[model samples]
Target: MIQDYLRQQVESKDYQPVFYDLKNAQDLHTFEALLKSRPYIRINDEIYSQLRELMKIRNPTKRLTAAEYDEKVQAYLDGVEIEKFGVWVYYPWNNQVVHLVNEADFIELRTSRNQHKITAAEIAVLSKKKIGIVGLSVGQSIALTLVMERLCGELRLADFDRLELTNMNRIRCGVHNLQVPKVVIAAREIAELDPFIKVKIYEDGMTEANMDDFFTAGGVLDIFIEECDGVDIKILSRIKAKELKIPVVMEMNDRGMIDIERFDLEPERPLMHGLIPEVDIPTLRGLTDAEKLPIFSPMLALDNASARMKFSLGEIGKTITTWPQLASSVVLGGALVADTCRRIALDQFKNSGRYYVDFEQLIV
Candidate 1:
């Protein structure tokens, strides 16, 4: 039975897959031509009724005749060049072209209710900013949330780690993606979600050599998100960010702690709230688990950590293998970081400091 199921899954199908790099002008043109060749407009009954009502409103003094309504519908269809506009996304996984509406229409429809909350002008501001996220563990959630909200025009992702079965606990992915680089998995998912947004990948991860490039290489990032586990990177990234005058944001999945450093506003701000004052990159990299606890505990403020997390940290090299993180906490961290990034980018909030989205505190 299992063999039969496996066989069925791999069997070839009648549908031939088509792939295209929409980034290329020729490929995009080809996609547009294909869409035009077999033009399709699917309007449900409800939308048809709405269209009729809209036609009636065109002339309030006189009710629209059936023939006039039909003419208006036809004119509306004639005006729509379905092929000419829209972001054409070619998904290599399934080999399909997912056509999304053009930018203006897309933004307006997708964020219609967000008008009073985020304001149209604020959304336009977010669309121009570029954000870079290093580390795709907790960073995965942050990346997806940002894309869903249309927070930035482009994203830069860096992570040397691959998707292992162990990562499934926090990183949202399927079993088929095992061993694939985290950056590739994230980029592919982002493309499927919004291919119009540009994504640049740093597969090698952020290192001392490429630290400068990661922060300022492609385009000056409006915001930098740091969520990796490397202590060296934690320190080195901030140094570069401070020098480049870019704001930095980080989320600790435990206890829902968020750190926002607005180096762009205060270049003299200490890294990690002055927790690792005198430590250099090499020194931080060489510290052992026991040796590093003193520094980390202070920064995390272990006294304020959740009971489970505090206990888990005490068992690092003993019974427990590593620090504990939950999907719940990671998801919350994503939301927290997204909101912080949005507020910071929009210039609505100016104070830079430590923040907690602790469920323990909020639930009560």
Candidate 2:
């Protein structure tokens, strides 16, 4: 019955439902607070009874008087979706509710007291999106940030390595996840965090051998976040994405700051791809250390002023992975990623190219 109601809500929007799971206590409390503040979320008598009982059981001394409960229920009654009644109580283990609404209209319904400005309805739009993640150190932070924001429906996590203790300083995984594949650990966290969210992990990550299959096989990824460390891999991914017309995003965390790039704005956009395609493998092998440094060094469009200011790359690198900077940058990166994803999905972001974040001077 609950499924049926959910189906109706989804069908009315001409979208299909892929994931539906119950929320945990913390999420439920958060949801309840959201509902209470909306003033427009109606609860039928049956549902009200259940909610009241939950409140009473959870806080016996703070139980609402019958009069007060009735009054509150009455206020929300006018906003009830009569046809969609009673579906919110489907999962009992967790009073929290998470649903992938097929339609964008529902984005208006998701809200929390802490973030009342955002609605679950808006998050649903995010859920319909799929993003490719290409690295695991800062990639871990990127993944966590996206999932927490409820920004994308599915995440395509690509990493070639296993978790090591050395990575604990910056990665999302911990001692319990050591030795586990980065993709596996990230997937487990995603499922536990939101069962309805879909996660596709590429344990081998992306490579010349498998890149074609990964990109062309499943649905086309809406955008890509490239965190892979190898210069060749980054170069190849950028060129291929341009050819395939998929947008690829990359970021570098300089000391406590981040620099992001969006390559392949138009289908025929130019190639910023580094080493593989045009140059033969032998030529790549022949390059000396002096030649290779330029290939690996980031290309900047910095103004003469910015370029003139010389700073040590080693110090910049050290600062980004440090405490407050690392944490702030990760959060900032995720928020930016979320905003970018939203614009792309809604067709609101007209231009697509590169974006840089310099935390040191708060410059972008």
Candidate 3:
């Protein structure tokens, strides 16, 4: 288990990410060269807006002599550190350093290769695939995992709420990132990791207005991962996947085990297969809060609004916390989601629908 290795504090320097600080002019120049050789940052709409503004300032296209480039670098440094310029510099030919920056004039940059266990050929297949994620919490993990795997050519992330301190336990972000919408965060993280990826994030709540984003005349989504806690969201997603002849998969964290469901590829699936004949989009989308109340209330039985209110006033001293569930479940759920995606992307698995597990049982 990763916990064991983490607890042991095993030393493996090679696995550590190297950070090079731009301390001097020489370091700055070296870093610039490194950045120039580094890859471009890929982004969806929100991030594209930010990068577009920077691109206008540092157009890399025209002509800049070494002296001119240096002048621009110094000017940029006046506002931000040379290290904070946001560029990835690496050489494909000799593995040497080059310069890259968020404000560079270049319209595009080199593509980054996936560093996970999966291979380029595997990613090539994923790039041709499209998937939609529902519910921004677990969906956030699914997004990061897929991006890290470099799986999925185009990703569609849907969520309504912005990041909050409550999400820090399960979501991969810091307080600095609080208030950033999940859609924006997902897009930025992808671009920061590899600018070559294609990401489309829907910050607005998914509804009839934007259902087309998931499936347009351009292309039908290849797969759907339902993470929305709303039963309506699942109903809608399953319906759409079935109508489009796309497959749908969903994962839920039950204690420590993950509950996985695959619909459309199998004959008798639960929830997803329950709504439509092989699942229809509208039926899925039409699910209501009332219907979900029963399904979710049980999971939240430990929580009490009165107790929570009392705790807020220091009466109960804060008894309820998501940390236990978040730590044991969220990360594992993400890993399982990624592994399942890898299998699906590689054409290695067809198992589907309503699977669950608990990690404590395994440990015991």
For all candidates in order, the CA lDDT equals 0.77, 0.56, 0.57
List the pairs of residues colliding in candidate 1.
none
lDDT of 2 at 305: 18
Which portions of model 1 show Cα errors greater than 4 Å? 1-87, 286-291
Of 1 and 2, which scores higher on TM-score?
1
Provide the lDDT at 292 for model 2: 46
TM-score of decoy 3: 0.58
lDDT of 2 at 217: 60
lDDT of 1 by residue, 229-283 (tens): 7777877888889888999999989878898889999989987678765666577
TM-score of each: 0.79, 0.60, 0.58
How many steric clashes between backbone atoms does each model show? 0, 14, 35
Greater-lDDT candidate between 1 and 3: 1
Q: What is the lDDT of residue 48 in candidate 2?
A: 56
Per residue, candidate 3 scores C-alpha lDDT tens digits across 1-364 of 9998769963221211123335556766765665566646221223333334343344646766556656655665577654445544332222333234442222222222242455546655776787777777777777777777667767787888888887877888767667778777776666556555566777775666687776653477767777775555555665566566566666555543343445446534544434223434445444444443444443333232233322432422245332122544666777788778778757788775444455455559
50-151 in candidate 2: lDDT tens per residue? 434434443446668898666655554456542233333222222233332222212222222214344556655667777888887677777777776667
Clash number for model 2? 14
